[model samples]
Target: MGIDDITKKAQEFLGDDKVKDALKSEQAEGVSDKLLDGVADAANKVTGGKFADQIDGARDAADKSVGNE
Candidate 1:
């Protein structure tokens, strides 16, 4: 799936409020590049590295949505 699709799925799974809270908390705490790397790593592991690009794009879109970018 594409980034938008992944984002939509995540939102659906996690709920908007939870997602917003996570984003806000992360932003307030100052997310590190290493954290993003960890996210990528987790995504890669979850998908067996088959959809790495899509996961990266989704992560970027999620960050943008949360006003981090």
Candidate 2:
């Protein structure tokens, strides 16, 4: 299968209700927070803090998507 096909399949799997529910679990919240924080931090460092605000906003949006307030 092509890379695009694999990506589409992965997206479909993640879009499933069961997968969404799993990502919304309380345990997932903690893990998501740590993961998002680390990603944002890494992004900020890579950009030399020039895009810190934007990166943080994007991180918050991603966190909310996983059901975290």
Candidate 3:
């Protein structure tokens, strides 16, 4: 799928509540990096690196949407 598709799917899977929780838990001093790394890794595994760029974009979008950016 495309970037938009990936982004929408990620947002749906994460949901507002989980995204908020992640943002809250990760917005702290040093946890965001680790959280984002985990997100990227999960995305990579899910997509098997076929849509790496889209996955990265979706992760960033999710982060920005939840105020982690």
TM-score of each: 0.44, 0.83, 0.44
| Candidate with maximal lDDT | 2
- What is the Å distance of residue 15 in model 3 from its true position? 16
Q: Please give, for residues 1-69, the per-residue lDDT of candidate 2 as tens digits.
A: 999999999999999999989888988899989999999999999999999999999999999987545
Query: How does candidate 3 fare on TM-score?
Result: 0.44
For candidate 1, give the lDDT.
0.72
> What's the true lDDT of residue 52 in model 3?
88
Whole-model lDDT values for every prediction: 0.72, 0.92, 0.71
Model 3 ranges off by over 4 Å? 1-29, 66-69
Q: Give the poorly placed runs of model 2, Cα more than 4 Å off.
A: none
Clashing pairs in 1: none
User: Given candidate 2, what's the lDDT at residue 44?
Assistant: 94
Candidate 1 vs candidate 3: the lDDT winner is 1
lDDT string for model 1 (1-69, tens) is 899999999879767776667765656335644566688899899889999989899777655655344
With a 3 Å backbone cut-off (N, CA, C), the pairs that clash in candidate 2 are none
